[model samples]
Target: MILSLIVAHTRNFTIGRDGGMPWHLPADLAHFKKTTMGSPVLMGRKTYESIGRPLPGRLNIVITGSPKPSDNATLRYVKTAEEAVKAAEEAGAKELFVIGGGSIYRQFIDRADRLYITLIDADIEGDTTFPEYDVRDYGIIASEHFSANEKNAYDMDFITYEKIKK
Candidate 1:
């Protein structure tokens, strides 16, 4: 299975606060949609609860210890991260997008082959964060920087990193 992290991180790698994302960047949202559309997205129970619903246009695989989904909206549920990855692969998914909170991100980071990161240029006071990874282990394959105007008031960069062979 090829796991990949899809996240928007702040300057300090902050991901969220109070369950919702700390910032809103249309460009980043668009980038996320473009990349993860039609693929299987695996997330933890807490991450699913945060979103309150499965995202459209993708196979939503929610991982929880209970092994069942609270609602019928989720595409599938798995007890372990390995099962989640397998389910997606069995469903003919070419890429597994790990959309996450801290725990899920950490659980799958080592399994990830690529990283799609949206770097937010701001000092955010957030409680959740993306997992730390060594930049030297991955090469920045692509990057697109954007500056938000008065309506948005923040600058961000859409970056994609591919793991380098050691």
Candidate 2:
């Protein structure tokens, strides 16, 4: 299965503040929903809690060191990234989207085959940030720039990158 990392980060790589995102971008949210609607999405436990519920129409896999019973049928809790990937494979996923809250992003960056990144056009303060990776390793497959509007807090670019084959 293809492992894809999907994230929306500030220019400085800031992804979260406290337990939630520091900015609100409805357009980005819509973009995310459209992109991963049918795919299985894996996120860290904290990321799952921040959203407060399982995202409908998709399998939600939460990676936590402490596994617990998930009341939602669409939600599954796993202890490690390996289990998360295995869960996706078991579900017959063609691609797994790694949706995150910092730590989870770090665990799978090197293994990621594709990156769906939303680059917020402003610098924002946050306690958690995305890991640094060599962009040269991935070639851009698509990109579109969106100017900030009433609905979106900042200008952004939706970019998709696929890892360069060796």
Candidate 3:
């Protein structure tokens, strides 16, 4: 199956501050929803805990070393990122969304074929950061620039990068 990493980060690659996103961009969120709507989204335990519940409209696969979820049918648990991806593939998924925290991103960075990155122009204090990317290794397939209002503050660019042949 084809794998992709989808995340919105600041220009400096900041993703989260205190277990949640530092900035809010409605357009970016809408773009995320549209892109991963019917697909299987794979995430680490920390990422899953940060959200508190499974996001609707997509199959949520959480990678954890834990036992099992308590009757939460929406949440599927796996041991590792590869296993999580395998689970998605077994379900006939063509693309797997690697929505993540730092560790998971690091784990799957080299494995993903594409990255759907929303580059936020503003920066805030953050703890979690995006994985390091080499521009020469990937080609920007698409992009959309937008700015949020006072309620959701941030100017962002939704950019898609596909890995270029080495």
Error of 1 at 125 (Å): 1.5
Candidate 1 Cα misplacement greater than 4 A, ranges: 69-74
Residue pairs in collision within model 2: none
Model 1 error, position 53 (Å): 1.5
TM-score of 1: 0.93
Q: Write the per-residue lDDT of candidate 1 for residues 5-80, one digit (tens) a residue.
A: 9999888889999988977777888889999998999998899988888899898998898876546544788999
Top candidate, metric lDDT: 2
For all predicted structures, in order, the TM-scores are 0.93, 0.97, 0.93
lDDT per residue (tens digit) for residues 71-165 in model 3: 76656898877678778988889999999988898999997899999888886779999988997899999988786777568777888999986
Greater-lDDT candidate between 2 and 3: 2
The numbered model that scores best in TM-score is 2
Residue 44's lDDT within candidate 3 is 86
The 0-to-1 C-alpha lDDT of every candidate, in the order given, reads 0.87, 0.93, 0.86
Q: Supply candidate 2's per-residue lDDT for 67.
A: 91
Model 3 stretches with alpha carbons more than 4 Å out: none
